[model samples]
Target: MGLTQRALPDTPVGPDAFVLGRRRLRSGFRRSDTSRFCDDVWRLAPVLHQRQQASLILNFPAIPARFRPAVKVLFYALLNNKPPAGERQLGVVTIHGYFQAFKEFLDWLDPQHHDRFSSLTPVDLCQFQKHLLATVSSAKQRANHRRSVRLLWTWREHLADDHIPVDPDRLEDDWNEDNSRARRRENANPRIPEQVISPLVVWSLRFVDDFADDILAAQDEWLALQKKTRRDSHSGHGARRRLAALMRRYQADRRPLPGGTEGQHGINIRHLAREVDCDRQSLMAPASWGLIEQAREDVGVDDSTYLRTEIRGLLDGEPWLKRISYDEDLVVLVRILTAAAYTLIAYLSGMRDSEVKHIRRGCLTTDADRTGKITRRKIISMAFKGEGTPLGVEATWVVGRPVARAVEVLDRLQPKRQRWLFAVPPSSHSHKAPRTTEAKTTKATNNDLNLMVTWINDYCRQHGRTDHIPDVSRRPWRLSTAQFRRTLAWFIGRRPGGSIAGAIQYRHLSIQMFEGYAGTSKSGFRAEAQQEALLARGEGLSLMVDRHEHERLRGPSADEARVRLDKFGDRVRFLGKTPDDNQMKKLMERNDPRIYPGRFVTCTDNPNRRLCRLPGEKDMNPDPGQCKPLTCRNVALTDSNAQAWLQRLAELDARLQASDALAPRVRVRLEEDRAEIQAFLTRAGVLEPADAST
Candidate 1:
């Protein structure tokens, strides 16, 4: 085959720096078209000739630094006078940019070797293969090289078949074998097989839910294609009607037509690349940017600004930011704080719903005046925070008159033993004990949450506010509990002037992303306390004094430190190591413990320090251990304390069984609560009666 070549222009259209290096363009010069695939070789001879002339005039600097030599050789091959006997020397190196690099790599392996067609040996080919593998840092690039080498070898084989005396060992023959071996090794041995799902594939499956009937119909047709032709035994009316309905919906949705639609938005893949600062080919790929946007719009998130924000969020791999409009969703906002309080503080305080659940109780009062008046009264329980130390959290919120009034009402209504204001009546629908199933205790189930989701979604739909979903192009919101913590983190981390006085008031009100959770950080409060303690040591103290003071401060008066450490150790005893060294080490290792370095030894070994116990114990002994109430040095475990704790537990349990309980529709709530109580008892070191079934 004759190489296809065009005469190089006398002047380069690009800047003065643009210059053509010797390279060839050929027609019918596929890598597969070797000497064996003759009859067309003569056609490429002229193009090769032209390439030779162009190469001589081309400037060295204009060509890629790596491809300069190969460019010269390709041109030289084109200019060859005699028709090459063995393998046609038609230059076609410029067909693909990668090919240029591939040729350069080949030359780098063996400077003297010009073309595989001329002469080569297995040892020489192997040497080149070894060099390419050793020098290329990227596995993908090396694989590409091996593929290219195999193609060259195939071309050589074709030449030999054409009776052109080409050496069998000229081009690397075992390249494919080597690559296969490497691939096997990579996929085997020490590493376990990992499942990597393409996001687009997942998105496609999700899209299937939105358009499953259409997908199934298309799949059915495709499957039918494999069957033998048969005479039509049924009328086309059914198929036609189904197709018509599908067409109507498709048209209404403005779906993409086969071979693309006439009025399709002409978003060039390259143009999208330029606009979005991404790869053009990637944009053009199936289920890429354009399709994702279309899917987003179908779901009702139609605002372009919202779309851009969502796209940016997706690219950054951060959780989506929920949009909140005060005018449109004030009711949701009203419930947010209360809802979040249960999620965050409940876990932190280790308080049952029957106890701290009632924020509006007289017991939470700050003032001595027990009168049911909203004056000088505060919610002490509401102000509580948690720490990883024996010192425990102190109340930060002061009770005011309004809170006191609510508390008074709660105290008057609450059972003598129970302090929770929101306690339900014993006849509540959610009072039944739950049956143990999996490790998951069922205070609530997906069905219950799904009902809430359904209600919220219906409410949004009825209000014509489909944008409840934060996505720029979708509507049916799928809210979950996991989002709660993330939303809280986002708000607390970004919201400014939140903790201190004299700070910018309501600074976060204008920031859309900053309007999620609004809880104060437990760790932040602990760190602040540490700062105060360090500050109390005085600025007059030198750095040496500061260090010495900090050391002296932490070294718990020998006995106190040892006792506290031992307590912590016993709690984390499951951790299989001492709390001071191992617990501290694990906390540091996992970055789990949130206490600051200068903070009091809160990661102390004492199990009583925090509401939760150290990890590794669950693995040590899988069977549920004996029940025990938690012990804390700050709170004496004397008979009074024990009795008080027990009474509090019972009261809380009672409240949980009330008729007006939260999530009253669910029959498993109280049961779940009991299960938690059981777990708490075990953690607290209390043992239930052996005969007790619960």
Candidate 2:
């Protein structure tokens, strides 16, 4: 425990001194906190997180004593060594995992006959793999253990005497069978289901767009009162005189004294202090109690609340909030408003949780036109993902008006001194909340989003409304910050032309996520969106196959459509294990140039017979805008397309009925066009022979 500096390993791995701290540490951390990197006990906490997992430590003592020194030296090397694959240093959590896995191998080997890790042979590693198969059932966990051993072998130069002699993985054999089953590019966190997200977003926007003014107004009142209290702290005779004068004015107006809200039914003493320009102690003093009681009895008191902040927010043309009167009421409202702001920025901007939370106070920026109208808005913040550093790089999101307003509201929500926008929600306890950059941890923010949902539902029930965010199977969908980014990608992939309340444009939002939206084209958003697009395409085709909807198709490539769709349906079918997104991705890649569903006509793309392909364009996917629906050889029509054409025919008939609006020649042309469409439908097996002649 008391190992001196001289007793530790003399040579450092990276710097002159070893740097064992994490990459993404907060401010005020000193690398010197642990001088002896070779110490048996080393702190592994990189960032200060609220969870116990953040408090990880390396316990070399737990390993067999002979192996301990070798393990410690190897860890120091791994910690200092930059990744070979052009990544940042291994994640702190990942290294901890490696330590656990490597320990299992050493434990299983119990290689007491050899003093060094390098003494182990390929036969020994093969035996260890056998031990893993017998003991560990989970392929993923077993792969982790084997991967850790592989890491030890990979760093052989640094290991020197401790390095293994042969490749422990032995790629020629099926030793990697456990890892072979693993899928690539699959996210562990499930994107929120659509039913939950739609209503959840609607309510979140309701709080932000409809209910925010009332909340912010109440916050302003609180700040003003706080300013008044801070300005006049003393409770001397001068203060007493001011208090008396305040009471006199109250009496002159014949109005009752302000009462407390939030389940309290008494005159607000703090309100009196704020009004009278004195410390609360002055109003609370025993000697002044009698005078206050006398004034209260003569002038009466309002039993509800002191603050008369008018609620300016409207819902369905009426005030959303009944009254922002009570101190508790205001505090709760501010928190809900914060959650709402978090929701908007997270969902709409396609930002990760940490990036959204790390947004600084003044991150929002705008580009205005020459006439002073705003053109584009963006948010600048730190991006931790793929920046290859502990502290993330500065990144920008080209956002819309809603995201801009949310950032503005967040800037005003927290205390002015707070550096981070997502600071502690102001409450009676913290006295305007601390000015710290870190507030809600991941779990805390998750709880906040869920609680906001609960609060919203309670509000809707009280207001006798039916549009509450519905639960999935009698329970609310558990929300995390993880869901929003991927959920936005999903929506962007499937419904680019969709609109929410004529406010949120999915088409514009999808554009903003890609390379064309901003100069930050190298950002990872484009990949996420394209991945979701492929999944959406495959999912739609698979669903259509499942419903047997392709049976009604009428087109030149109808047989090819059925064959491709049936194969896609089989590939996606859950024989035993449901395929993950990554597996589905692989399936879709092989089945490219498949059916593309459209509103007007389903394109069963055939390259040779194609009519929409541009002269020089080599793109396999047909351009839907250039689609020759009526004459193209690729065109297919399902029952829905038939109905769509029928609706179009009815509309054309209505237009042709407008005799005053059309000349004889134009009417004749219209009739000919109608006849052409009717005949095409009849030839395509959509209508009977008599209707075609008519």
Candidate 3:
């Protein structure tokens, strides 16, 4: 065994030297028969050139070493091959997942087969698939594994070198069965229900308004304290020297220093700790010898008692500033103010979480008209979604007065050096060293919002307030970053005329308002609005169908409604629980019996007879707002519609009676309006001929 050693090269291997020369190569090569079997695997390194892929390759050397030529061929094909015309390069996550699946397969195959992966038959792959199905319980997981395996086989087949044995057509045909069983649920983002939002908004607004002075005063005190601390560090050498002398005397005498002992000059540990430059624990530390010496040189009595008396006097003068001295209390107050500002901006502006985080100082600007009057308040900030686009892609949200005030409050929270509007103190355990200016990350912002929710609930509980944000189902309504946008969209889409303060404003109904929020992603606010609309329509249809089955649909459109309901019932049987959009479209095509429950009208959408002015000549879309259901031949009125007309008629009668001294022409116009309502009521069988005359 000792005599079987290989000879070494004569020359030293420098950087430019050919280390693979005959003598050195023979000496360095593994003598085993299997060593050269898959030596070409190293050639695939160029294919896995991406940092992530290369790292994975280097880290998981076992996969390449065990699978040999097959692994190498797969990597080469994936790296060097161009994707099919509409396909994109696989994302890093996808590639990583495939690598994991291949590793798992190799682990399973190592014990069963001694041959290289290139020598395995189709039966081996079938066995692997069977093993995966038996071992993997999740349908999605199985699908992922199957997809990775299929891609591997496909790559092996496409390799120009024919290094791996694979039948591409046979593999594809055998793996044709569907394993993807994941069902996507609709309206997945949980919106803060209206009940919770109503109170949350009211409480938040009240907190901002009623306690504005308290909040501002606390913030100012915090700023003054920060400045005072800096000034003390630079100019309190005399004070420090006096305190050091007192500390040294106490240490030398092994007793309290004399002056205000009892009712005299004895220093209170608590008061001394507060007045000193260091924390309480640090003041008491053994390493305080240096600080004590420095303080001893500037000879004077400890002035902590006087400082405490002055602070108490200040607090007595302003009752609101009493609790501002407590660090914990000050932190809570700051958090409350932060939460209030965040809520106002998020809900009112309808900005995404990322956009909100990117909001910097001075983001709010007022736009003036030609007359120099401040006409509109706008928030100008960078939209991260358009990062790679040309300039002028930033989002500018037109906000109201409340939002502007919130921005102002946020501006005063951070130091002038801190540019971020939502800057927060760094965590104690953060990897990066703490800095005075640090902006809240998206995740941190979300967490803070959640903490705010908890704080609000806790405050309400302690104060015995009846107003508090309620929960959905039984769980505490866990607030998400997406909820702010979705909840706002839900309200605007469902209640265009709903009162917030007093009246419905045009800003609430503007299309551009939502476009700014939804423009951040391909499927943003518009998709959310559409989904909400669809869900609303579905719910209404379900209720209508239930009413029709109970023979409750007594109206002009009752017969037509019954026919449509029967057709929907038949389709429901075949389409299962929830029919997709395409299925619903096909079902609604013939006769097109779409219901406008909000307007109390049913439209049998006949383009030739349609009377909606909002849609163009070539467009078949109907606008419920402009629907002239009373005059259109395709319109059908239900009981609700009849009742609404009667209510309007009564209102008109009251107005006519109230305006008895009006001009004859005004009376004539009122009479004509009254006559139209009576005619419609009579035609719908809600009023008799005699009743119309009356």
> For each candidate, what is the lDDT?
0.33, 0.72, 0.55
Candidate 1 lDDT, 1-694, residue by residue in tens: 1121221223112121111122233443453332211121222221332111121122333444333333333333333322345544333322233354446555565456344333545655566667767787766566656544443443432232221133323343544333443453221111100111111112222222222232223323322332322222331433233334533453576542222111124322232232333443444444454453453355422221111111112212432224322122222322321232333232222232322342433445343446754433333443222333222333333322222333343343334554444443121233244422111111332232233344434545665644222221254333333332233332232332223211212223212112111132243322322232233222212222224322232221223433433343344445564333223333333432122121112222234343233444532211112222233221212223334545655766676667465566453666665565445443433426551234
- Candidate 1's displacement at residue 275, Å, is 27
Better of 1 and 2 by TM-score: 2
Query: Residue-wise lDDT of candidate 3 within 497-565, one digit each (tens)?
Result: 455533435345336455545544332555556555655565456556656631444445556666776
lDDT against true structure, model 3: 0.55
Candidate 3: TM-score? Answer: 0.64
TM-scores for every candidate against the unseen true structure: 0.21, 0.78, 0.64
The parts of candidate 1 lying over 4 Å away from their true place are 1-98, 113-118, 155-694
Those runs of model 3 whose alpha carbons end farther than 4 Å from true positions after fitting are 1-86, 89-187, 193-217, 227-325, 332-350, 365-377, 382-393, 398-405, 425-439, 471-473, 491-512, 515-523, 549-562, 576-592, 660-668
Candidates sorted on TM-score, descending: 2, 3, 1
TM value for model 1: 0.21
Candidate 2 per-residue lDDT over residues 325-420, each given as its tens digit: 655677767777877888889888888887788788888888899999987788888776676665657788888877888888888777788777
Count of backbone collisions within predicted model 2: 1
